[model samples]
Target chain A: GQQVMQIPQYQHVQEGEDFTTYCNSSTTLSNIQWYKQRPGGHPVFLIQLVKSGEVKKQKRLTFQFGEAKKNSSLHITATQTTDVGTYFCAEGGSWGKLQFGAGTQVVVTP
Target chain B: GAGVSQTPSNKVTEKGKYVELRCDPISGHTALYWYRQSLGQGPEFLIYFQGTGAADDSGLPNDRFFAVRPEGSVSTLKIQRTERGDSAVYLCASRIQGASTGELFFGEGSRLTVL
Candidate 1:
């Protein structure tokens, strides 16, 4: 079984501040997908990184995959109240099974 | 439907009861997945279906849980003799064929509560 570990199980950020969450795997990963779940809501797809050392941006959110493909990071710049949610990183298995990380719950305060 | 749809957004039953949750994936999608998520935790893989066949069910916790996608469209997850531990949010997701690494479209999920 493959698993991903996320750091800073809980994150409290000030409005307009920037923060980063990391996801690491003990084994190499083929692809990594990021998701966000708002309070009392279902998880929604954010982005997916497949290439090594790849980086993608969505508005103020930046997603990066490690050169070794064993780690990934999601950084939110100038966080807003809309950024309040739990961010999850998942590994896309060969047969379409997605194993998700415990997630980093972010809370932004004004 | 435009996105995945799940029925009975919430379910509540006593222990030892039988329950069934249904998932309707996006039309034309060939892959469907079931996951369970407890409060404050991420989604845990449960089963995956490729068309009308169960591609990978190794994630199922035990025999009490079973799922089917007979016509390669709608899927139903059944649980017999449920326990309080079985309480969680049952999430269903779908992915188009050949997009193994693509993002998954998820349903709002069915929250199960066992008393």
Candidate 2:
């Protein structure tokens, strides 16, 4: 079975601080996508990385795809309370099946 | 522009009861997926439908679960003789065809509680 691992299962940070969550896959991936889910809410699409070693930024958040397409990371700068949620990284396979990670939970307190 | 919509936001039933969860994906989107999320866990893939056909259903938990997408649009997830362990949130998502990212637009989800 293929597995995707995410570290720092939980993180509590103060407003204006920074936060980072890492995701790694046991096998090579065709691509990766990031999603966020608020507490008790549905998951929302954030961004997707296709090219190896690709980095994309959206406002204060930055996402990176590993050069080998086997890992990814999401970094937030000056986190805000609105940034609190569980972040999941999904790996796309050759069959087009998407494998999701366990996700990292982040809590931002003002 | 409507997003994915699921009927019966919450369902509470006893063990051995049968239940049906419905999903209405966005207009013109040809790809739809269903995922289940347990408490303190990320969403797990249940099945995916491409057009009117189920492209992959490897994630279905057991024979008690079934789904259908007859028109290539809306879908229905049917569960028979539900068990207490079946309590969880069922999420539906949709995306456009030939999408490079395949970034899914999700519905609020249907929460099933088998008591």
* Winning candidate number (DockQ): 1
- TM-scores, all candidates, are 0.97, 0.96
Per candidate, native contacts kept equal 0.86, 0.72
Query: A71 in model 1: Cα distance from truth in Å?
Result: 0.7
Docking class of 1: high
Minimal lDDT window, size 10, model 2 chain A = A91-100
lDDT of 2 by residue, B26-62 (tens): 9999889998989988788889999999888999999
Provide the lDDT at B103 for model 2: 86
Sequence-dependent TM-score of model 2: 0.96
Q: Please give, for residues A4-98, the per-residue lDDT of candidate 1 as tens digits.
A: 99998999999999999999999999999999999999999999999999999999999999999999999999999999999999998777678
Q: How does residue A97 of candidate 1 score in lDDT?
A: 76
lDDT of 1: 0.94
Q: How many clashing residue pairs, candidate 2?
A: 0
Q: Which stretches of candidate 1 lie over 4 Å from their true place?
A: none
DockQ of 2: 0.72
